[model samples]
Target: MLALQPVDTVAPAFRPEPVTQEEAAAMFRAALGLFGKWELTDDQAATLLDMPVRTYRRWKAEGPGRISRDGCARLSNLMGIHKALRIIFAEARRGYGWIKAGNDAFAGSSALDVMLGGELTDLMRVRRYLDATRGGW
Candidate 1:
């Protein structure tokens, strides 16, 4: 006689921690660094971040205060795009320059041009494009 055992198919529940102000500030700082690498102007960076140029400059000079949920999401997407670029190109300069290089995927427009749309989905679209290009979902 043989006995059959049933395996558990349920996955454990996942609860992510709440985003803190300090963490959001840190992300903003990282985004600023990426902007510098991409050679984005203050106005361009502000537009991409969906913030006013004045606010962006303030944050750059003083510090990032509490970031909204949408703001956090935007920052995350921007960083994800940078990370995927880093993985796709061997040289960091190539990855940084790729943002301004024309691509057929964007109708001959650069990825930076696409992201400059100033919408969260715009940033997400760029991130997804880079992620898929680098064999990520």
Candidate 2:
């Protein structure tokens, strides 16, 4: 009898590809649109984007410009979260409201609360949770 050996299946590190100026702007716009749909306050939006209130206001008014790589990553994760919510929930309202609704996954905290931690990891956590719920993992 021949002995079988186990195969290594470790995935590569997740390094996000560089985004173009237009792609970054488009993602920022999409995230802002989701913010409006979710009825998030200015403070909440600022927190979600990991930006100061003043900077948020400037971006809101002036429109998305050349944002930093971190900003692009944050917006991309938020957009992914929004997309995952829409995919998981049947109703549009439920999808939109889920952000503010308490979730057992976040220790009974709302997804918005977890996102308001003002860190890239917080946003990624919420996005990853939603993706997993949708079986995208």
lDDT of each: 0.92, 0.89
TM-score per candidate = 0.89, 0.85
Q: lDDT tens digits, residues 40-115, model 2?
A: 9989999987788898999899997578988988988988998898899989899998899998999999989998
Candidate 1 regions exceeding 4 Å error are 1-9
**Residue by residue across 56-117, what tens digits does model 1's lDDT show?**
99999999977999998888888898899989999999999999999999999999999998
Backbone Cα, N, C clashes tallied per candidate: 0, 0
- Scored against the true structure, residue 83 in model 1 reaches a CA lDDT of 90
